[model samples]
Target: AQSVTQLDSQVPVFEEAPVELRCNYSSSVSVYLFWYVQYPNQGLQLLLKYLSGSTLVESINGFEAEFNKSQTSFHLRKPSVHISDTAEYFCAVTSKTSYDTVIFGPGTSLSVIP
Candidate 1:
């Protein structure tokens, strides 16, 4: 079985500052990691994922996450954040056996302050 865990429930950052959202997971076998963002009143959007190949993955919008198999962690980071970046972020994990089902973390609410 695989499970995801988000270290923070809420994260507040000033505009134009760097931020990092921590995520950890537990699995006996190899797993695929993902990060998703949800804007207000909108569906969850895929931010980035590490399905295969390189352990590092990035999104078009400047979000990056590295999959550390040894640590069992996939932490998301951004160099600079904007107010529009504020949203709910979720970390998820899935294995080959349970590809249809993705286990998501509690979620971290990111608030950008001006």
Candidate 2:
């Protein structure tokens, strides 16, 4: 099972500064990881995902996430956030290879104080 220590309840950041959201994962041999971000009053959005290969996001609004095995951490980095939008981000993972699989965590709701 993969798990994250979870970031602060609400992360405060400046508009033009870089922001990093850190998440730690358990040393599971095979797993699929995903990031879901939901802005205030909006539906859940897929920020990025790591299933088998290259961890960097190809193209997603200048947002990039990487899964590092050496450091055993997953980080979500953005060059700079231009808006002060409050968001609810969740970290989800599964220990299955197929698309239709059951998730493991109890689910987490993280708030970003932009």
Candidate 3:
């Protein structure tokens, strides 16, 4: 079984400040990790993913995440945050054998302050 967890449930950052949203996963079997963003009153959108190849993956919106196998973590980071970046972030994990079944973390709400 695979499970995901986010360290902070809420993150508040000043505009143009760097921020990081931590995500950790625990699974006996190999799995894939993904980060999704949900804007207010909107559907969740894929931010980034870590399936194979490089340990790091990035979203087009200036967000990046590194999959650390040793740490069992896939933390998302952004150098500078914009007000438009505020949203709910989810950490999802799925086993390679059971890709259809995805487990999501509690979620982290990011608030960008001006």
Candidate 4:
């Protein structure tokens, strides 16, 4: 069975500050990595993903993460965040195909303070 683990349950930061939300996973077969964000009362939106080739992946919204196979980790990082960035972020993984459904970790809530 595959599993994803997110180290922090919550992260609180001021606007324009840097932040990192840790993630680690274990799977017997090849998998795709993804990070999704959910705002209040909304569904999850794809943030970034690592399928193959480059170990690093980025979101259009200034967030990035690297897939580290050896360590079984894919940690999300943002150099600076806006108050609008406050949301619940989920780290997920799926077996190699789009048809393969993702399994999510307990989400990490990011609160951006003024």
Leading candidate by lDDT: 1
Question: Candidate 3 residues 32-109, lDDT tens each?
Answer: 899999999999989999999999898998999999999999999999999999999999999888436999999999
Poorly placed runs, candidate 2 (over 4 Å)? 99-114
lDDT of every model, 2 decimals: 0.95, 0.63, 0.94, 0.94
TM-score of 3: 0.96
Q: Rank the candidates by TM-score, best first.
A: 3, 1, 4, 2
Misplaced by over 4 Å in model 3 are none
Pairs with steric clashes in candidate 4: none
lDDT of 3 at 75: 97
Report, for all candidates in order, the number of backbone clashes.
0, 0, 0, 0
TM for candidate 4 is 0.95
Off by over 4 Å in 1: 98-100
Looking at model 2, report the run of 10 residues with the lowest lDDT sum: 104-113
In model 1, how large is the Cα lDDT of residue 68?
Answer: 93
Q: Write the per-residue lDDT of candidate 1 for residues 1-114, one digit (tens) a residue.
A: 778999999999999999999999999888888999999999999999999999989999999999998899999999999999999999999986754589999999999999
